[model samples]
Target: MRSAPRTEHVVQEAYVMSRDYIRYVTGRAAKAAPTVTAAALRHAGDDLLAKYPIFFKRWPRVFKAISSDNACDYLFNILDQHFQPDKPWQKKELTWSGILSIYVLAGQLAIHCQSHGMECVLEELEVRVGEYMEAKVCPGIREKGGWSGFVERYAEKEEPERAAVRACCGVLLLLASISLTYYMYRRLR
Candidate 1:
């Protein structure tokens, strides 16, 4: 008899592949932004979704729900609420803060899925990506520089690479917490 493929193997493979693709696409998209404008981020997201139709088709309902204006507004509000800075330094801080917020939210989604015994489907990933972009680019009203310069300064001076790594670690911690919570939930049942 043929042996069935392990579910864990499938999950791990999918997670790594998807994460790498997301990082690549996001970096390119971020670099492509004309300015730190909401329209720019939305356009980039449109580009990403256009490139990955199969992923969106997998969870049509979730995609539809997330694509709504309200969903976008909610994500925008979250970023505005958390990362709003009164001073110039605070405005600069928004870059890292926004990125970290998305990582935390993605980790939360993972936790929600684990608790419900649901796989992290493509729709969930799409929504998470959208949320990340919306948070990162929507708030700044003033245009200090063009997109290329902004990306360079943010990437080099701000050290977004380091911040991203730290955010990934934070996501892992959130995952561990989810696993622990799920264990407790299961035991209690």
Candidate 2:
């Protein structure tokens, strides 16, 4: 026998719960307007939930989505938003490893958001990465221009389109790392 449909209240409650989790990871309150564009991400997650009631039951699907072509586009768009040459870069002296660390953290957070039935927008990801860089990488390189220096180097040497392409490559690398981690875990099991 088929099960009865869930009440609207139930669905709303689920969405609220998911939203709260997202806010916690994103470090933003529900009432606060997201500084970055995340509406699309949220909608995507909600849509997936509606189409597949137990979408979160399988972790792999969430992982796959974050690493998908769609995600690459999302990441690239956000980078383009922040790295416009018209606006000077703010932090520059961050080390390559520090940048990579921030990206890795972003990938982890993306996975977490997806697992909890939430979408992580590109702006949201960029904000989180920025915060991470400030907290972890800025201290060492604050004198060196922090993130601005890195951006200036790229902006001076590379065209905006090329920079965006490179950022996409970085996103792909993160996704590949996620895939590798999951494969290793499964193999161990």
Quote model 2's TM-score. 0.26
Candidate 2 lDDT, tens digit per residue, 1-189? Answer: 212122333222223333443554455546532321133334333444566656345544434545433554454454445433553766444354344333433444565555555564634554544443344344454455333443343222347899999999999999999999999999999
Clashes of each: 0, 12
Off by over 4 Å in 2: 1-94, 115-132, 153-189
Winning candidate number (TM-score): 1
lDDT of 1 by residue, 1-189 (tens): 212222333222223323433433334223343323323333334444567767545433442334322443444455566666677565555353344334434433333333444343424554544434433442331232223432343332346889999999999999999999999999999
Could you estimate the TM-score for every candidate?
Answer: 0.27, 0.26
| C-alpha RMSD (angstroms) for model 2 | 24.1
Misplaced by over 4 Å in model 1 are 1-80, 84-93, 120-122, 135-189
> Global lDDT for candidate 2?
0.46
lDDT of 2 at 131: 42
